[model samples]
Target chain A: MWEIARSNKRKSVIFVFLMALLLVLMGGVFGEHFAQSAETGLLVAFVIWVILSIIAYFQGRNVFLAVSGAHKIRKEDHPRLFNIVEEMTIASLLPAIPEIYIIDDPAPNAFAVGRKPDSAAVAVTSGLLNTLNRDELQGVIAHEIGHIINRDTLFMSMLGVMLGSIVILSEIARRSLFFGGGRRRTRTSSSGGGQIQVILMIAGLVLMLLAPILARLIYLAASRKREYLADASAAIFTRLPEGLASALEKISVSPIRLRKINQVTAPMYTINPLQNMKLAEDSLFSTHPSTLNRVRILRSMAGGSGYDAYDAAFRAVTGQTRAIIPPSALKTAHATVPSRSRRSDPKSDPGTDQTKQAPSAMGMAGAVLTAAVLMDAAAEPVTPAAKVRETTDAIWKSRGYRFIPCPCGAALKVPPDYRRTDIVCLRCGRKHPAASAS
Target chain B: MECPVCRESMIVIEYDDIELDYCVGCMGVWFDAGEIELMLGKSGIPFPSEALRFRVADTDARELRRPCPLCGKTMQKVCPEHGRVILDRCPAGEGIWFDAGEIREVIKESAGAAGDIVLGALRRYLGEALAEK
Candidate 1:
């Protein structure tokens, strides 16, 4: 794991360095065309890059959470999600558990963010919790943790900031040129170096137009491979490739598109939220491998849930000789997959059994879902409606909505802005006072 | 979100995981498109995509146009087949708006078990607020 993460970090640094160089070149060209000196543009671009990188290093995670409207939740708010995250954290051998957040949107997606593993956070949509089963949810959380462990979050942020700066600089230059603000500078420089100045201006204009697209391609190229690595990491951590494969299937087929996502944050998601369903095939501009390909790779991992197995599966599915997992990481990989029955059997594994017990005990106290329900879920799948309700209830709880349980087995959620002092129960026609209920 | 009918800030009421934005002033309900699909889909009922699709009903031309609570665009009156309940659906497919009495009427007019399940859930939750004529 360390070897894989270290190699990933090394590759990330190279990508960031190359993108930074691209940004500086763009700045220099635009500056020469507009301000008549490459030094000023280069310095300006460098300063912009430094400032943006600093901000991303310190506050990128918070900015992402705020932009996506994710609200942080405590263990009591959503124990199931918290438990899954904790289990994955332990399984991945991380030093600290990442903070958990929930997005209210019904789109089933998730992402991880932070500059370091210890400070990282994982966020999932309410739709995700509502949609996925326990095994599937675990698979998704493990995948996000895969990103954190692989240092993809920090790398992606730095790359995103560089991408942003390139886009902004080019946009400003394009607008300035379009509005004829560069004409005066061109005319002034024309007297000193007439022919060369005209050539330089045209070259700068072309560069400015091509710079953003180039930066986006670089960003997308860097992003797509990391997703496969993370997927492999998730499989090894959970020992359940089917969980992730099915979850990807559900996510890809989901009809609802994420409302709050933008170009910059789109790649951070488990799946590219911005990609249209019809256009989900592999493309130069795509931030992720095609879902079909990813799922096929995971499903075809015949040997075991290991880096070596994933490598073989990748080759089989894509018909490419190139390996996805680093050879060094594969040296220390597990030889065999643990059986599914052993994992499901609470008595067989004490470590996992303890984790399950904690949540079930808490569930008993809250009267949310009893041990019997959990057991039933383990045996036969629970209805999607029940899972959706449980997940949404957690979101409401995090947002300060009060839950009032009625005798008719209905738990009514009263909004914070509910002005009425007394509210009637939606079930059983029983009336309860809002002030006293809380 | 502000109610399109009464223009009053609405209070969200969550029951069985489906959130309904209810206007206290007019007793009207706003059913978001996403939530409706989730509710129907989870319940194993086929989503009434045809009924909810943007179709301008020429019958209610005299009714004042109401802006959709979500997109702020003027909503078109759509009357689902097999029902006389004219609903204000966002042209952008945001959601549907039902006046106080219209919800019950739509439920009554709706075909098969799909309507009964929704009606039962709504009646159980909203009680007299939805039962009122």
Candidate 2:
């Protein structure tokens, strides 16, 4: 894992440099064409790059959380989610548990963001929480932690910002050209070196138009491989390949598209929320490898839970000689596969009895018990409605909504900004003072 | 969420883990698609595939069209197979909007265990409001 992270960091530096060069070239060309000064264009582009980098480096995680409409939640708010994250953290051997966040959107998706594992935060949409069971949720969480472990989050953010800079620069250039900047350039350049200036201007215009697409291509090419690695890591961490396989299946087939996602942040998610699942084949523009391919590779893992098994599965499923996991990592990783049974099921595994004597075991047991009770209490056994309800309630609670329970068995959730003093129950018509209910 | 009818902010009312956005000003209710599914699925109610097969109702041409609260698009009016109630549904299938007393009317006219459960819950919680008229 450390080797992977080190190599990832090295690749990230190289990628950043390449993108920076692209930004500078684009800037210089645009500036030379528009301002008739290459130095000024170069300077402007460099400044934009630096400002974006600084913002991404320092406040990128918070910016992502805010933009995605994610609200930070304490452990008490959604204990199931927090517990799942915690279990994955311990399993992954992460330095600290990443802060958890919840997005209110019903589209099932999740992403992790941070410069480093210790400072990381993992956010899942309410739909993901509502849709997935414990094992599937663990699978998704493990994949995210896998990204954090491989330092993919940091690389992706920096790359995303650079991509943003290129897109913005090109957009500005395009708009200016569209709105009569071309006429001004032609007028100014017709004096001396007219032929060469005209040629250069055309070349610059072409570059400006292609820069964003070029940057996006580069960005997409680099990200797709890391997703497979994260999937492999998720499989290894959870020791349950089927869990993530099923999760990928569910997420890919979900009919609801994420409402808050845009192209730039779309690559950060477990599956590209912006991309149509039907068109999710390996492509130059895709931010992720095909979900079908990923699920197949995970499900095809023969026996081992190590990187070796994952590499073998990858080759077998993709029919490619090139290994996804590095040979060195494969050599170091011991071939050991844990039993595929649900590890969290206390009833199925009596080993939990021995672990229950430990202090932390109590909390784990309680969470499991609570989950069990909730699942059992549901009238329909398969829908996981109780879990969905709990997840949504947690989201509401985090948003500072005051929960007022009516004697008639209806719960009234008054928005924090609600100025009304009284709320009439929809089920029983009992009027309750909002301020006094709490 | 703002009410589609009155444009006033609505409060959430939850029963059986299902949340409905209730408008105080218009006495309307918004049932989110996902939440309704969860609620129905929880109560062991089999949601008919054709239940939400909404078509543009031509009879309510004189009525003002309301925008969907979830997505600010003009909602299409649809009359369900079991009821004469003309409900507003988002074109994007975000949810259904019940105006004023439309929920009770739907409950009274609709048949099956699903309607019974919904009606019983509504009567228990909003007894006085539903009893009026």
- lDDT, model 1, position A280: 60
- DockQ per candidate, 2 decimals: 0.25, 0.44
Models 1 onward score TM values of 0.78, 0.78
After superposition, candidate 1 runs with Cα above 4 Å error: A180-192, A277-281, A333-381, A408-410, A426-429, A436-438, B1-125, B130-133
TM-score (chain A only) of candidate 2: 0.86
Whole-model alpha-carbon lDDT for candidate 1: 0.79
A283-389 in candidate 1: lDDT tens per residue? 89899999998999998987367777788999998888998888777766342333232245455443443334454555332222111212323432388767777
Which 10-residue window in model 1 chain A sums to the lowest lDDT? A365-374
Candidate 1, residue B126: Cα displacement in angstroms equals 3.8
> What is candidate 2's lDDT per residue for A386-426, written digit by digit as tens?
77778888898888877888887778888887777787776
- Model 1, residue pairs in steric clash: A426-B125
lDDT against the true structure, per candidate, is: 0.79, 0.79
Q: After superposition, how far is residue A420 of candidate 2 from its true place, in Å?
A: 5.8
Candidate 1 docking category? acceptable
